[model samples]
Target chain A: MSTDLSRVADPGSIKLYTTEPDHHDPITLRSIGFWLYMMSDIMIFAGLFAAHGVYGDAYGTSKITAAQVIDPISALFPTLFLFSSVLFFGLAGVALKNNDRKEVLRWMTAAFVVGLVFVLQEIWEFVKLAQEGAVPQASAFLSDFWTIVWAHGLHVIVGLIWMAVVLIQVLRDGFTEAVVGRFLNLRIFWFFQAVVWVFVYTFVYLMGVS
Target chain B: MAHHQSSPIDHPEIQSASTLQYVSAFVLGLALMIVSCIITLGGGLSQSSTLTWIGILALIAVVGQLYLLFKLDLSKTMIWHTVSAVLTIPLVFISIVVTMWMFQYLEMRVMVGGS
Candidate 1:
């Protein structure tokens, strides 16, 4: 049996038909890989939350202040602030896409300041809790509490660093195509912080108060 | 992997951002957070009911964020990430539910005076 190979080419040109799919270029691969990494991060959060659900109330024979140490009012600021940062970071993404260099930088600076305020408030919260004698080593629940919240805090810190790098690069290089991927990834990272905080507020803080 | 000739600006995800979406998500998210605080501190609901309401509100907030901020949707290119993110739900539910249940039974049987 003979197979008739069909090809479309210019005169005196040679081209072969490819049966296999084209490989993903670096850009596509970068996004897919980053998304997969984020999925794994989600799993880590799930495990931590499970630990919290399991041992969150294991303070036996010890004075459990429970929710009294955490002020609900204080918690609201961080949520609003971080969510606002997430919103501003998103606006930065829009600016980046629109090729507006200065606007992207401005949005990023605003996001950074708002995000810093959130981190500082969180630090203040931890300090107040420590002063109230509800340190990480207070009990099993506090251990889980500090671990999860700090894990999130660590992410926020890293996000701040990444945001700074992206901003600096954009400042030096302008909003070229080369920087879009990095900026987009930072947007995703910032959004993840807000998402995780929702879980923290729901499971840990709200439940504690309840 | 298939390279279409569309410009990068024409990509759905890149151009999906909007001030309306952002502000709405922010306001709605802020409201949900405040509502949670109020339910907690206002002493309107019982303990279990408060937990339930807060969880429900959180789900609403997360769904809103996923839509407005992340711009996740069921489009051809976006569905991959969206499905991957949503796939973790079963894992989270199972992990939290099973672990909490296991420990709850264990404590009920073998211990006393759980906080």
Candidate 2:
């Protein structure tokens, strides 16, 4: 295998840089593979979303409905904060464009902090819901609601942990090819979270109330 | 991979990042969300109309965010990612829509009067 590391002319989507496709480029392979995983992950979410649609009004044996439990206007706060985190992550991508490690770290830290706020708010929302007897055990409607929303929250928490690890890696190791590749994949993950949230707030909270 | 040290900036994906795009997407998303909340909370519209508006706003938010933040454009660096992501849309629709349809039909046949 020729070790010529010249930039690939065709510019495969996630490739870092390589003229020849003879050997597996670690970053490129990892990113493309990770994205495929994300696609499958989204399909799982689709199933959950579909389940929610079917069980949406199944408030069996309970007097409460989704509107009684979820407040669409109040839900906007966490949504905005989550969107802010995405913007911060995108800014980190721009920082990466300039290869400015300090800027990247700063923006990533900002993203992490904002993301933390979002997760905390969501946890509080769930806490309040549980306190109001809106637990997943309450009804099929609440079950579906909690399941889908919790799934998204779990991903956010995982993303935050991943962000912390990436921040530490960037601080300790600087921007090595591996570190940058991991950051790239994390960016995609973070962006995907916001995309899913758009649907959650729209389909679950907004339309649920309506 | 270890022998060749390259700046991450040189990568086309990173190069595609635009501060302007991200900022605009954020602003657009925020504006749309506020409008949606207003429409939902104001109770000025019927339930169906409110649902329709929310769906429209959500679609706009999705498209804006996908294009700007995810950079799912037709550019050479993003074409593969874009194509793959787009391909999944139909599957999402089929899964969600088919399930809803099945349940709706079941309700009509099962219940004396449909919900």
Candidate 3:
């Protein structure tokens, strides 16, 4: 194809084009971007999960297995806490729909509190496991267990921090487009964490014992 | 931007939020969790069967959360989000399922005393 010299000369008329669909709405863009990030995050967790599946039952020379180290019954409490946290966060979304700033803060605080409990409960469970000779160094199974669970725990901690930041922004600046966008993105984030937790609970704790 | 200026709450992303759906989703998840927990703890089924049950429950919970919490719907505002998510479904299966299959074979062929 011959070069369009005249088009190049008129730089102002040289309109750049892209193959991707035009996404001009900031709100739509924000959500799609966040969902893409969540997909990447899911891949990270997927790798951890696969690693866990491989090493989960690999007790090696040790007599301890995943069932011995993990207790689904004890995990039930933290699982409930995490689920309730998601529920409260969803309620916060409802509050945002009504533009009830105070109610939004209230529901979000509830979400944060329950989320904190979930994290604390997880740490406590890990501590107890470690005390019972189930440290990551003990066996391949324990190593995988700790790695996956702790990975999820770290995400929860980050989610909590993000939740706190959004709450503060709403309190200080009111609900601007940016703040609301952040809130909506965080909604995806918080829900994504809960979904990850479901798998972790199932494959790690429940199926560990199964 | 000035012409579009309005309450952020009026955004369709916010307007579609539903408390009832959220509550029901949570309850559904809890029910699945409870049932799986009982079956797992009771040891009524074989290991493979128990694993299968747990897998089914987890799948249901994930779907419920995607539908209710994330609003993966066909509405005007949510359609793109839904499409992006649906596209990722294959990757999700490939990542977890394919990895498990590969590792299972490696365990049998390479690991000593593997079944």
Candidate 4:
């Protein structure tokens, strides 16, 4: 209880955390809420996947098969691009941890560019499929494919916008606590997209072709 | 800095990022994609077996990203994330398996052969 100052701080010190003096860790809810949203997002994808499972091969005497329409190899390039984005984003996450503002910005730019390419490639695929008379109305199989894949594409676009906003926040504000929370949730969102894409590649591309 | 106003980076849940692991995970995922393409296009395996191998490889890739990228171990920091992610697992299988069964049953009951 000495009032005298000491340069020597206690070793092995730890403190219980609270977000605000009177608010019980409202920050944790930012992440947890995003986590829950991701769960519900999973259910949305699950419904789409179920539709694919049900209608994918069940062309119901229609001449079109998923195999004839989908180019599995088209997905591979986008896979490489998007997964690389994830890697870059992971690097950005580390940079954010170190509070290296420049590194965070650099890696985030890389991630955003790569993600943009992936989205462009996806759009290209959609155009080609549409020109080939493979619109959603063509078959239940096509309907499910377009719905599920476009749903994912929309998420990626939203993620791209979120990332842009967060990137600006980081560039403008440095690693403030609020910025960190948004970035963390966006990391989860970005990562979950990659995860969902893996399944899409396997089930939609590889399985569709094989 | 005041004791209560500590850095968010100081939190126990925020593990130091490993560049090597993240790169390795990326490489592993890319390798799996190549292998899947080979399996499908190389004419090595029958279609059924190709699908099976691709499924296995995809699972490996998913688990790799979760472990390497997200650092989703059962560490104290990852408990909530781990639990929430785990909660989605059963739902995935249920959606897939039940959909397959129901569709197969529906096809059997209603439709033509091999369309």
What share of the reference contacts survives in each candidate?
A: 0.67, 0.72, 0.71, 0.55
* TM-score for all models, in order of appearance: 0.89, 0.89, 0.89, 0.87
What are the DockQ scores of the candidates, in order? 0.56, 0.61, 0.54, 0.52
State the lDDT of candidate 2 residue by residue for A31-71, as single tens digits: 77888889889998999989988898888888889889988
Order candidates by TM-score, high to low.
3, 2, 1, 4
Off by over 4 Å in 2: A1-24, B1-5, B112-115
User: For residues A1-210, could you state the per-residue lDDT of candidate 3 as single tens digits?
Assistant: 246887787798787897787645677678789888988888888888878877877887777787787788888888889889999999999989988999999999999999999999888888887788888888788888889999999999999999999999999999898999999999988988888988998889898888
Residue A67 miss distance in model 3 (angstroms): 1.7
Q: In model 1, how large is the Cα lDDT of residue B76?
A: 67
Query: Superposing every Cα of model 3 onto the true structure, what RMSD results?
Result: 6.5
TM-score of 2: 0.89
Winner by DockQ between candidate 3 and candidate 2 = 2
Model 3 interface CAPRI class? medium
3 or 4: which has the higher TM-score?
3
- Tell me the interface RMSD of every candidate, in Å: 2.0, 2.2, 1.8, 2.2
| Docking level of model 1 | medium
Clashing pairs in 3: none
Residue runs of model 1 more than 4 Å from their true location after superposition: A1-18, A23-25, B1-10, B112-115
Q: What's the ranking of the predictions by lDDT, best on top?
A: 2, 3, 4, 1
Provide the overall lDDT of each model, using Cα atoms, as 2-decimal numbers: 0.81, 0.87, 0.86, 0.82
